[model samples]
Target chain A: MTDSINATGADGGLGGFFQNLTDSIISQIPFWQDVLLPALWDGLWVTMQLVVMTAPLGFLLGLLIAVSRVYGSAPVKWLAQLYVIFFRGCPLLVLLFILYFGLPSVGIVLGSFMSALVGFILCNSAYNSEYLRGALQSIKRGQLLAARSLGMTKMQGVMYVVVPQALRRALPGVSNEFIYLIKYSSLAYVVAVIELTGAAKIIASKYFMYFEAFAAVGIFYLVIVTIATIGIHRLEMKYAIPGVSGAVGKVSKGH
Target chain B: MFESISAVTNSAGYLLEGVGVTLLLVGLSLLIGFVCGIILTLGQVYGPRFARWFVGIYVWFFRGLPNIVLLFLFYFALFPFMGLDLPAFGVAVVVLGLRSAAYQSQIFRGAIQSLSEGQMLAARSLGMTKWQAIRSIILPQSLRLSLPGWANEYPVLLTDSSVAYVIGVAELLTRTSQVISRTGEPMILYLTCAIVFILLNYGGMMIIQYVEKKVRIPGFGNNEAECL
Candidate 1:
């Protein structure tokens, strides 16, 4: 896209070469205004808000559902199962549409951003509950017996004994779901919530620079996921139970 | 309400066509993803370090990026940059397939890892090569074991294929949007679309469950708790 004398371009040496390259790329495209700097910055902020707002809330909702499904009475368990089935089976985009478009027909209205958040919260909670349910199942039955023997109430035992351990065991799976939440948050853009992917689309269509725009967006996600992966690994180590798979080899004592 | 019902019925042909496209996307992508997944699993588990690193990056990118972003990237940028100019349907298949491969590879890798190492060792001591052991001994069992996890991928890809509509792939969601624009009854149309997806998902899961039950090993992987 650029036509110039390459030999004459970087007269200032190695530093000049990079500088010229940056200048050429900038000149060739309105990189800052359209693609790279401000666009991604604003998009990143929105994306952060989406993840930050959704992750904890979703996890708590999921934890509640998981607990209910595992520990609730017959009617409660059936209700939980139905909720999981509906949310889990419906595609996120379709759910967003139903929330944003379908709900308004019934006198319930949500703005575009709120609609996305609600949909994501529902979807996330379903999957998160599945993960937590697995963790709950893995715990031994004796745990509840011990808590009861210790005179703790049913809620107290679940809260003080069972949940802490289940949470630790569930950390890896929960983090995996959190990573999924990060990616699916991009779907918010579908309902006109200008998150990262939405911003890239706007810029890409505006400038016809799909490669640069999406590539930058891709890099942004890659960095976030990579960091999350490492963080999850560290958390696993920190919280690893002695006999669990992720724990280091047990120490030995010599006579 | 009557007009809305008639509108949906009138557009039923178009919606069915969209369903066909959606199924084609899911089917072809699953096939491609399965093959690539096998190759990736072997590479990550049995191949050299460099091969593992390459597959690692492949999985990382595809898994990390949202489906819509990847759809746009392939449909708009990468294919055009390479001068491929492939059809939207084909592009959707490849992108979705590759993304599925990333997840599928992990599923396979887990299955392969669960196979007892002594099986391969015994095969090799019986004069079979590594590849032969993998082909004859390991893969047969692991592939069966992988079926349960792989079955879960169906619903995942089914949901993900909805993103292909963003690139004008004319899938179910896209058709519903078109129908909505025409009928001005988004509630009914979108709910219909949702019900269709739920039906498709549950139907696929039922088939997978049948296969899983028929082929399941008696002592291992039968416990629903561990399978999860």
Candidate 2:
């Protein structure tokens, strides 16, 4: 078992099938380790960069949109709503295309990386704002009033009191969105950003090992998604309160 | 603004034609998804340990990969290796269908699980076999309960179908880009496609909402209890 198995060309039986599988897999190990891993690692780095750059800005912009929707004038609320509807309605691929290919005609050409960044932020923020807005609304107005009565300004109340609770409530949804972002960021390749899937695609075409290349890419994503899921679950547990609305009380509502 | 408006010309009916392909892609995938979803749900809820294990793996594999990657995998690898030689459009539909099944199965599982064991017990006591009990007692209410979540799938699938353009499916997004290449109206053309997509999103939701309203069994529903 320590050495690589090379059962060559056994045919016909179930045992032969296993032997062929062993030989094929042994042959693939060198190709996978030497060729696939290095290219995919580079692609994964770009993918991570896309996710990292997009998430915080997207989170902050989503917060602004959520706040405006919750606490702004009538026109301001409408504008935020319109923004979410338009941005969320357009698929990310189309949005990226609009930024990359479409914008040059109107003289606002973004390079591939920049186009992908802007497009992901726009799409991400819209959904994030929706989740945040829901969480924001779920907070009772009495808390805001109480903060104001305690000599805090309206902005101060929101900054100090309301936002913390809303964020906790929004955590599940936002983390869910973050998972989606990791998956959807693959679309950046459509705009010519050579991210993980892009890297896999190039190697796959060059070697005609589409299954191996793409399956490796899938493994990379599953690992990323599983790690994110575990991390998010831990965050949820760390912040879990004894008697919170989104946290505890809903969990016991079984039939 | 007027001159710009006049300059905003489109490829006559070509993009509109894509709307049909897009709908067909989603429609076919979702139809297959619905049937397969029911099977997956049944396995998850009622089948033995091995069946449940198989369903879990199916859902996990489909859900873990991104849309474009799966499309490329099937188009370039799976179909070719199996000697199926499905057209790219066929491959797109199969991938989307399998993916949608994974999501929709969860919706059905949640709906079915939300119903208490009391119903099954009652059906058993009344001389109904397990299969009959499920057919008559369980499915009716659970299917209705799953409507809102199932309806949410339309928009999800619609958005996903746009990814088919990567493999040249002649979908709305693909056609919109074609129009843009010829007319150079990226802003106007893309904007129109966005609006069309938005309308499709809301329009389909509106119909689902109508069906939901029509199927209301008063005092037998949870209000906006999100399954996902």
Give the per-residue lDDT digits (tens) of candidate 1, residues A13-40. 4544456546646775667554466888
- Clashing residue pairs, backbone N/CA/C < 3 A, model 2: none
Q: Write the per-residue lDDT of candidate 2 for residues A1-255, one digit (tens) a residue.
A: 322232322222345445544675688998899998899999999999999999999999999999999999999999999998788767778888888887887899789999999998998888888878888888889999999999999999999988888888888878877888899999998988999999999999898878788878999998998898899899899997765537311211000
For residue B67, model 1's alpha carbon misses the true position, in angstroms, by 0.9
- RMSD per prediction, one decimal? 6.8, 4.9
lDDT of each: 0.83, 0.83
Distance from true location, Cα of B39 in model 2, Å: 1.0
Off by over 4 Å in 2: A1-24, A245-255, B1-10, B225-228
TM-score for candidate 2, please give it: 0.91
lDDT of 2 at B157: 89
